[model samples]
Target chain A: MAERKRRRALLRMGAGISKSARVADRLFLPVVAGAALLTMLLTVFHRQIQEIVSPSPQPSGEQQGPRADVVAYTVDKVPISDPDSPVWDNIPHSRISLADQSIIKPLKLNVPAEPVKVKAAHDGEWIGFLLEWPDSKADTQAIKVKEFRDACAVMITSYPSPPEARFMGTANNPATILHWKADWQIDIEEGFQDLEKAFPNVSVDMYPLLKESIRDGKPPKTVDIPEFARVRLPGTWAGNPVSQLSKASPVEKIVAKGPATITTLPTQDAAGWGRWRDGVWRVVLAKKMKASDGQAGEMVIERGQTYSVAFTVWFGDGGDRGSRKNPSMLHTLYVE
Target chain B: MPKVYNWQIGREMDYWYEESRPRRQAAAVFDTNKCIACQTCTVACKTTWTSGKGQEYMYWNNVETKPWGSYPMGWDVNILKMLGPQRWSLEGERYVYRGKTIFEAAAQSERVLGYLPSDLDYAYPNRGEDETNEIVVEEKFYLRMPHDLWFFYLPRICNHCTYPACLASCPRLSIYKRPEDGIVLVDQARCRGYRECVQACPYKKVFYNHVTRISEKCVLCYPAVEKGIWPRCMRTCIGKIRMFGYLNTPEKADPENPLDFLVHVKKVGLPLLPQLGLEPNIYYIPPIHVGNINFLRMLFGPGVDQAIQTYNKAIAGRDLELVAALLLNVSTDRIMTKFKVIGSSEVAGYDENGHEVVRIPLKEPAVVRPFYDERLQVYRHNIT
Candidate 1:
């Protein structure tokens, strides 16, 4: 009688388990179909959903902007400071996201965000980078009051700290900054811009200091003006490198301990050129692999070594300048 | 951001840095009622400091005809538009600004709410010159106190404020305020030609040099001030409308100091746009003849009504101390720290060292000339 009762309970338990399993099997197809529909909708409205979710589009996971790593390929005697060199065609490019600089004083939080395509190459003697970014207008003139010039810079630190450290580095860990300005490129391509060049019809009675250069009842060229007259320009007289009219290269080497302490290195060891074509700026910045003796604030480049590199961009038409810029996070630059 | 007390606004306001007052604030009081707009101060400043290659458009000192005139094409109106509508409330005995300052109204990207002027904006340094509040073509035109149609000359210079917008807005910390005299200046060597100072200054005093590709402004003639002399603009004012002295805070107000007497005791002098929260060192005695109190209020703050009344009393010879203060303007090149009315006829000024710098008769003695000059045998057409 006991054995018969136990058999009856076991049979009831088996029946209940079978019924629930069958029900679950029946619901499985619809659940898969619903999940597929939800995924399709999400993929179709991905951009809209991102806009709703984030104030700024995050450049992550194979986005068109910059990635986390860049490899500097070894090449033999690629033309230094030439963005249009044919060698760039053979090299792979990495896209860099231009992040808004919202961490510092006089921040530029709203940037015309875009991806900057970059290619890095190095011979044994020199390391160079070619950066290409989009800008609707070519603003190469900063001589006017409201005009600011398009510019880009590359910062290379020792990569001694974590990636979360200051992009420009701190006082203890200094970074070497190579800045290329469009206005400086213009100065090299064309002659130095002066007040007379900006306003063709501007007239003045006389610049008494420039009397020695004035002739034929016409104003003298900026180059013709003597040193005595140039002293009147307090910036130039005070040895400010930014105010210097003549330049052998468009790029200037600057040393910085964070944003507030950016000073142009007296011995500039960088060279660059920038060209704006078809609403895009392609710039090449080059630096020596090793600094000459007594050359201060220069980063030494070496092969088979990794260095942390970052980028900063300024869109001139948007009035981007100084601490107002778009900066990127640190990326490992492998010099192979 | 730190909150600092702005005595001009009679309230605490947001500032980039902490409250740091100079040892002796270099101050000046301009009697707008007496200014003739001869451009003497402008020329003096031009020849003294800004006569250079890239400084053609710079005017450290400029006198504009008010109600429509601006040196940099709508500098005041443009900033005012950005600042939007502001209000000043009379709380107890002081007027408190209940509006946002340039620093407070700034966008997230900037330290101050500012706009960069175009090159053409400075092309017309004297645009709307001599223009009145409105067209004066009524058939029956009559002059009255606070006239139906009125205009006055407004001379401007760098205020060298206690909290300078230029100094606050500099990203690289190129601009500084001197600890000795509160004179704000741009260190040319450190400036990278960003022109942030040019955009930040509310008065549009900071100027950008096209040739040099850097920004420059009025230096307040520190070289002259270091030697206890007045700035070129103040000393060369032909109208005798400017008084240079060391001003103290209201709590440390010196009754005998000319700037303190005019600014604190009599309250005849008022700061330009005190709502901006710069605590500007320069003060202007409002024009009593201008009819629109609202217009005056916008430029000189809520103190215009009382300032005009006090100015009218001083002009009427009812206020001897105020009259003596005005008489001492341009009396000597030395910066006068103290002044006194000498009896009924004379006023005396003392320099920083307590030495009497100047003594001038309040009223010049006039002698009538004969109708015909006996020596030249000619009839005098004009006689004083």
Candidate 2:
């Protein structure tokens, strides 16, 4: 009777173990399927889910830490006007991709995105950006009818509130541009390029309304001073910025409201320098941090603020000019 | 793309903008047969308009030897080559272009089918000056009715098209055609030197100024045109080959209008390269001496034969109204609105206000001299 009782207990134990095993087998596949479905959904809508979880990280109440593509580290003396200064050795660079401008009437197609290396440094009183990009050729003279010059610009929103960064800016949101032209750089370095410099072999007999210093009762065969005959040059006489032989600064400060609405500001408070070396263009654009003398259209840079910045580059060898350029999307520029 | 009516092609064609015709289109008709290629018009235009520092090489008006010459060194030939082989089909009386125009042939990224000329291209403006079609060999040096080695002078200026390609190609919309007059102009204040207009203009009339860093073209002397005066080039035409006036559409053709009589009634004046579909306002009376039908058809449209026939009839005294119309060309500085053949001997031109501006006799009075003078013993050189 004792042996039979022990056998019954053993059978009960085995049956209980089998029942638990069966229950585990029944639940295995469904659980795995649920896990897989969740994984696939998360993979497909990860970005959307992330947005829902943390809405736009654009500081609403308090001061936010540096969360941007570029961080303008506070340096005692920012290399404000030098592109090739050794002060840029320690600053980290961020790479930005530039795509063609295709949102307007004139579209540039079939071009691959060009990558640019950018670094920023700010003194207590001024801020500067150093941009370096690859270009096979350096075109510095825009003195020929068919020739265009290489150019680059950094656009910062005039107001702290970030607006849409396309078409330079919309009507309400204006973007101030610090445009550094390769030709203008050369213009500031060398004397203003003239027609003779463009066409070395070209000869002219005389020009109307030109100032003359009579040598032995005869005017010189050639006169190089185009300013003396400004009346003959309608563009120069009409005060066109592009036609000006002498420029105060290599960088031009402009404000834009959509394409073709770029207006040069009367008070130009920006300076820049560009150097082309070994098929690469290194440019530095600098401006005052605070608005002085109530300068109109000036982009004021404040501490502990995030501003939206964009970049544009033109390859003169590729016949890029005006709207025909490589443009970068808006990037967050945080000032520490 | 918008479909616009190009009356020159007699059908709707692709254009960048909607159909907006001017209230009065500024038009001109050039008589190629009477042109002497004196280049006085070119000089007059240069002195009056394009005499600036950067405009040294720019010629708003130029006369080139045909079959060889061009201001920008094969401007026409290069554009034709790019356009490839295009054709025009005769649908009833009006010829419809069967091939794609510059606008229609444009790529998705571009507004017009065009090519930018290099700086050297403009360097040689007179590339084939006075060059003939064929070399005159010693064995066959004799002249024929249609000369074996033939050439003609072709004077060109901005056609100021009813649908301007320059205006359409400009991304900034700097180029504009006046609503008051169909004169096209590049705004000095707005142009950013994109050179799209320079490339898009089939005639290559828009020139880029190196010093100004912008593009400039013939303004058609709007300041003078606003005052009821002809352009400098037209007014100073030594050959009297140009007739400047406002043109109306074919449906509104007026027989009393000189341009209408020559273009619509007599079918003498033909648009240059009407197949291009810009509907250029300038018209040309084809050279009757050129026997090459294909060449004439390529320069002018399918109406070349009819134009030559009408012009021949006018010269042969079969079309007196056409003669009166031709005789009134450049007769006065004022824009002639109406013309009349006065009593079979004179042609009278009236201005916009119905004021008779000019009257010219059909034949000048001739004077004859005696064989010898009465007192002097010197015989008269040949008595007329």
Candidate 3:
């Protein structure tokens, strides 16, 4: 009875996992569709499955120019992050957004609840993921007031059971999350614009701290001292501080651990990135196997090892951020 | 989720479902009427703590004109706009805010009806100082029609509220309010510079350090407070405006207790924007320049009328007996918990042990200084 009720509850919860999930904010959801889906998922995944398990869709490599129609289950196959890889032809492609009901009641999510087309690949040394989506606004700028950028993340958990401790993780178990931010990607690609660069025509009085100042009519005054040379003025400092703040240079650096542990990347760990654009965004995130003592479990895909994975997406425009984001349930995957 | 009753919202609000009852909660009182906009407290706070590179645009302690200035360039105006016009109707004796509480509005949202202002917004602290008041034109002839123009100096610091939005917004759960003293702080070791706290704080007190990539705020001089020393802003107040101490529980509240007397017993001090329902620990004696009833109520809640009347009585000696006793320790170096109205014009302050720490008269007599000093090398003391 307890298991039945839990499944029923999960079904009800996952029923309205989209914008239409609100069902006009008063109704719970269309129970019929949810019940049917839940029954099918439960039959296969069993009682322990908290996530909605949907069959993988073939990657619709059909974007601008479609050569032909091809469908393959990539989750069951060896997936790579490279978009050009032949494996991408067979993968899950759908419009997916927030599904969990935890944030739905309170947050009025206003983003494209489209299932982002996902393609995966692994080349022994590295595991890569390619996420492509169509957004009218690229929203790559996140450094301004009220400005939000589009972002996506992935979470991996090796432990099957751990008493449901969620403060990052209990003392014993740890989860590794890899977050990729659009703003960080942009900054990494082209350094954050400085005040002068953002506004070339504007000139103002120079404070004592600025290394290079263009005061009114005088030749640009240069501070000769080395110590003062490194001093960054308030508005003048640009570029993402991740590289400057952490030892990692370039923005969007990956830390293996959860939000609590944002320390340096784990040992022997490496990340590769590729972003394609054509009226939309296609981002590829690839990681290599490595060893680390970091509290955040390392992101290493050992051959024949099964791992549980989840996903999170941040649509900056919809003000989707922090704990106020849509996340997916755990799916088991084994790399070969 | 554990729920706490918020009097301002006139309802119970949900917390993060944790048993986080503090052993002792921190509290403070600020007399905005006495503030002179000297910026002494601002400088003292800056030199003591926020002198680092990334903290240049940050001011944990800032003072601005009531209606004109805000450190982050319209922090109040922006929040008000997001919240729109608030609606409230008195439910019997208590006033219940009809609009969404700051938390409720941002229940599952990323921010608490706030925006993280750009670097330019924080560049100037006094951009609109004294500019919100009516502009008066001087006539050629001396017209006898005298109009009263007023604006109060509003000094701001972290309230370290009972339910800090910053703590609730952090996904990493890095921000923690010390159970011993109730001081809200961000654990540098754990913070990822997510800036969620920066957005969630209604007052925008939490700052993101670009260099180290972490959140830092007014530590409330915890190192000094642990040693029983008052916060630097309170201790160095040239205008003698700020009060610092831990608030006693409702059961332990005594009229003689400084924090209780000003905040509860006398009801002279009120929290800034109680409509937000964070249960802010820091309370303010509303500035008299707040002639607009709605403005007054918006800042201090429906207690505006009562607070102003009570403050007027207390400051004007209508209730001099209790007033003098409460403010006696305004000049004392030692932080006191109790006060006694020993005489008509004099009062004494006592420490936690009931030991007298200071006794000051209603007025201190000033003496003329010597014009010349024997230790002077060349110039006289008075002839600079």
Candidate 4:
């Protein structure tokens, strides 16, 4: 009887182990499924996941355009300087085709479909435009000719089509443009000599055109002295009339019409700021709507008036700059 | 594509496209005889530009063993196979290439001959030519073979051709030869990584950066050139076999200039492949009897034999200025627009503006080291 009881006990123990094993097998599938679901969630909300872990500021979602009648209004309570303001969240959006702008038709296939988000506000004296877009790269620096920087321009023109002007607007239409440059911002934040700092071993002598002396041969050994004045290559050097080397500004006022016709305005009142976060760029451009002495271009905004506005964007990594830029057709802007 | 004239082939050859000439251009020549395959030029170029992500396969400056080696692995062989055997016939002074150029190979809408090389194919560079198997005639004499293992280092860069196929192949018209320097460059803002330029370059020079998704190649170090400095490759050479200068027309070429003297006078430097009709600005001083003569002749056209003979004669005659100019003065930063032999001791180099760049002495400098002596307590020169 004792041996039989012992046998029965052993069988019960074995049965218990088998039952536990079956239970574990049943639970394994759910565990795996849960893990896979978590991974997928993490991938979808990667930006949010980063924020959750780090607990820093988070960028708001994409902005939505306002109704057709809702003109840009003056704001004192909401922040106008910050491009990431929630106030911009209520504004309308326009998705421009930068890819099709390619001169070569076949090249358009590679361009990504993206749109530019914009919002406008005024403090009576200062007019502010907040622009945002998705950019995989920040591209805040450019030192070499091949390296490019992200840039944005806002073209504002007077009503009634003053005269014939190209897309940039002509002297007759007189579009007052506020251009924001990421390169110029970086130049202010750090310096273009950063590349030199990175590649400290590779030193180069300044070019003859960069030198102040009127002679040529070997570059001067010392930094304080000049080696040569300028280079006389056998062709016409048509530099961008609006740009000059060894200088930088976050915002610039320019006017142009047609090719090779851009001229930088003398005004220094415009100011801009830009920041890239989580594959998106937020930019703010602010300038006085009225001229200092009360005389202004036809683009001067007035209450209850309608005006034309155009936009151009350069995706630094997308190879958009100069004439090769994503341009938008004229859009109506109500100055409320 | 329209029929146009190409003078680079030394004849009124037909080109499939019409392109306006650049005002002028910078040119180069490499003396392969002195090359040790150190790859300093390659390393310098990589460090300067191609050291970014997605540029791992790019070698703006490369050196491969001739008749045996090629970058993009088998680029020459592959193209040759596709084009078939190129035949040429001499008509009076001009020789015509019967084979199709990249332009001629393409359809009317296409600007150049384009073939997408598999990504795996770009992995290997400088994969040289296979050797001839030894013949066993009656006995085991492995030494005697007609096509033996003959090879020499052939360093290459962008030809910056008078008629660059890369420039023509770009549908966006972004690639341009600068009117100032004739340096062909793809505008950074205008390019959209189509790899058309990569497909068009017969030399397989232009590389596509997968990360940047754009085409990039040698810029000829224009930034430094504008400053009157030698390109990093020429400046940092282990062999001193490189020369950088401008190519002028026959009427405009400075007679005293080292470039003109070697190209037109001595006839020692020849273009790598003139039959392509691209009129490449880069020149090469053929390797000295080190590789297959017929193969070298095919590449450099008819100039191989004459170039070798002239180089030998110059070396034998102890022509100091020619030798000095060919070797260059490593100690100075002067660009030699022209060279002159001064007496028996030195060769003088001048810049475009009549400024003396360097004065390289034919004789070696004697070193006098000062060492302390225990007994004499006097310093003396130690000559090696």
Q: What is the C-alpha RMSD of each candidate to the true structure, in Å?
A: 8.0, 9.9, 12.2, 17.6
Candidates' DockQ values? 0.58, 0.41, 0.14, 0.02
Which digits, one per residue and each the tens of the lDDT, describe model 2 over residues B277-323? 89999999999887577898999999999899888888898888788
**Residues B254-345, candidate 1, lDDT per residue (tens digit)?**
88899999999999889998888899989999998888899989999999989888878877889877888888888899988889889989
For this target, which candidate reaches the highest lDDT against the unseen true structure?
Answer: 1
Lowest lDDT sum, 10 consecutive residues, model 3 chain A, at: A64-73
TM-score of chain B of each: 0.96, 0.97, 0.88, 0.86
**Predicted structure with the largest TM-score when compared to the true one:** 1
Q: What is the DockQ of candidate 3?
A: 0.14
Model 4 scores a TM of: 0.53
* Candidate 4, CAPRI quality class derived from DockQ: incorrect
Best of the two (2, 4) by lDDT: 2
What would the TM-scores of all predictions be? 0.88, 0.86, 0.72, 0.53
Instruction: Provide candidate 4's TM-score on chain A.
Output: 0.61
Worst 10 residues of 4 chain B by lDDT: B129-138
Expressed as tens digits, the lDDT of each residue in A1-336 for candidate 4 is 999999999999999999999999999999999999999998878954553233221122433224221245667633534677776665654443332343322222244467676667776777777777788999864433235578888877765453233256765676778888886676555532233322233333442343342123222111222222111110001122222223345877766553334556656667778888999988888677775422335256675667666667778776555554675545556665
Error of 4 at A81 (Å): 29
Cα lDDT of model 4 by residue, B1-384, tens digit: 555655445545445346566666688878888887888999998778665433556799988877667787777777666666666666786556666676666654455665556654665675653332233244543343222544578888999988888887775565888888788886654564446677778887887653333567889888998887778877887888888877775456666887777776677878877766678888899877543677877778777877887887667855555676675634355566788878877887888898888877776788655565558877655523
lDDT of 3 at A162: 45
The residue ranges of model 1 lying beyond 4 angstroms of the native Cα positions read: A1-68, A212-222, A293-296, B368-383
